[model samples]
Target: MNLPSLRATERFANQMILDACRGAKRVHIVDYGILYGDQWPSLIKALSERAEGPPLLKITGIDFPSLVNLEKTGNRLVDYAKSCGMHLEFHSIATAAWESAQPRYHLFSELLFVNCQLRMRHIREDGIIDSPRKLFLEKILSFKPVMFFQSVVHADIGSPFFIHRFDGAWRSFLARLESFEETMKLELIDQSQLDFMDKFIEKCAMGAIACDGQNRVERISSYKTWDRLARKGQFGQLPVSKRALEMVMSVWSGHENFTYGMDENWLLLGWKDVVLNALSVWEPIEKLPRFKHQ
Candidate 1:
């Protein structure tokens, strides 16, 4: 997460989360793919540190059954939050597929936030009603979060055909960067950074020539498709102001090698089309359910 672009994305999301829980006693955040659980500490700190903010914060981190240590991670976070005088009800839920887990909506209350970062790529699985995209809409509409935050990688590669054919300008740009040895110098980059850059190049090259048309693992669609889905789900997009975009880009301001962009939907993506990370916050078109008032 040392990548400036990535750090910017996380910062953007953190602000959005804070805004959503501005003045509340309780907040529940459902993180679809809680990968490494790295983003929560900062968020927890923010909530606890806020002088006048939500009094209680509850996070329900959900992921596939493969994340064996999820509860252990959640407990650690819980302990950390408690030490800081914040009540963090951390729960780790393991399920086969989050889309199919829509029936689990009863687990969360109305003061909720849905954080779906880089997890949309797995939302489609070859069916009509059971499609990942359809289920994603259904999942959010179920609880109708006060705020919805989503960020995806290479969101423009919606289809294998599009992945096969890169824009003329983009292809040339990648070619130029790949040949530049400066990016791989140990003094300038770490093994992790080198690994990320190498794999990204390999994916683009392989995607261009690989004959298997239906094997795209991260089946992602463009932001346009996501916009359409959001509207269909009766959600309204909140603009990420110029100031926010500027903040997101601030990290890369002096870095000459990186390029940053904000799509029409105000989603942020970096490094041309290769490393796409768009972030958008949405509010429910209608009031969502809340726990019964005393």
Candidate 2:
């Protein structure tokens, strides 16, 4: 099974809520697509362990009805809650967001990571899921917590970022929430935060070494800026995760611009910005496993 994300929207949101659990009697978590609900247990553990608390904890996990691993994921969520001494309940929707969407609140931890959404790009207008997410928040603004953590993608491999272009579907989704009369304090993720997978960086360095003794090293970038390989010591000294960037770069080659270099979180609809960031890959890692080669 894949490990949960330390940098995921869920985990990040929890981090923001680690404090200020006062008056919070319950927590709500919405997994629009509950892929095994695998992240919930760890998140619960983190919440249970991270901050000092009072007032019993109640966690409600809501998911799409058709998930195959619903039973397993729900069981894990329950077990984790019991072990952590938190109250737990599970709810599911037989329909999809496409079919219909209902505002959901699942848990009440000190950490608040609400605007968790998949992203997409539209040419005529911008598509920001957070826009609708704000609506969701407006509905719950009365219970206003301290911090809200959100993660969104600014770049992707193709013309549309939604894994495919979304036809104002996001705007339509957000429109559903706009009827709320109030709004909550909001913040967006800056560009510098999520730039690379440690593994992707390592792969880049590996590819550099594999490139040859004389190949010219062009640029190195993570999620932000791109720079050229410094010297003989640069790639060789980078950690395996850093070198893994080479593979991600290779993958970027297929993209209009390596979004990783352009700062993986930058809005990608502009014409002027093409190449993302440059990841310096030519170094060597000692005894590191090699990523797939091109």
How many residue pairs collide in each prediction?
A: 1, 46
Clashing pairs in 1: 123-132
Which digits, one per residue and each the tens of the lDDT, describe model 1 over residues 1-294?
A: 455545666777777767656666677788878866777888888788887854677777878777557788788888888887778877777885676664233434436778877667666646666776777677777776777887764434454454433453255436434533343462377767777776775664454334233554445556667777788878888888565666677665544555655565656555533545567878788855544310
- The local lDDT score (0 to 100) that residue 58 gets in candidate 1 is 71
Listed per candidate, the RMSD to the true structure in angstroms reads 4.3, 20.4
Question: lDDT by residue for model 2 over 226-280, one digit each (tens)?
Answer: 1111121122222223223333333233323223332332212111233221221
User: CA shift at 107, candidate 2, in angstroms?
Assistant: 13
The lDDT, on a scale of 0 to 1, for candidate 1 is 0.65
Best-matching candidate per lDDT: 1
Show model 2 residue runs off by greater than 4 Å.
1-8, 20-23, 50-55, 60-62, 69-71, 103-149, 156-294
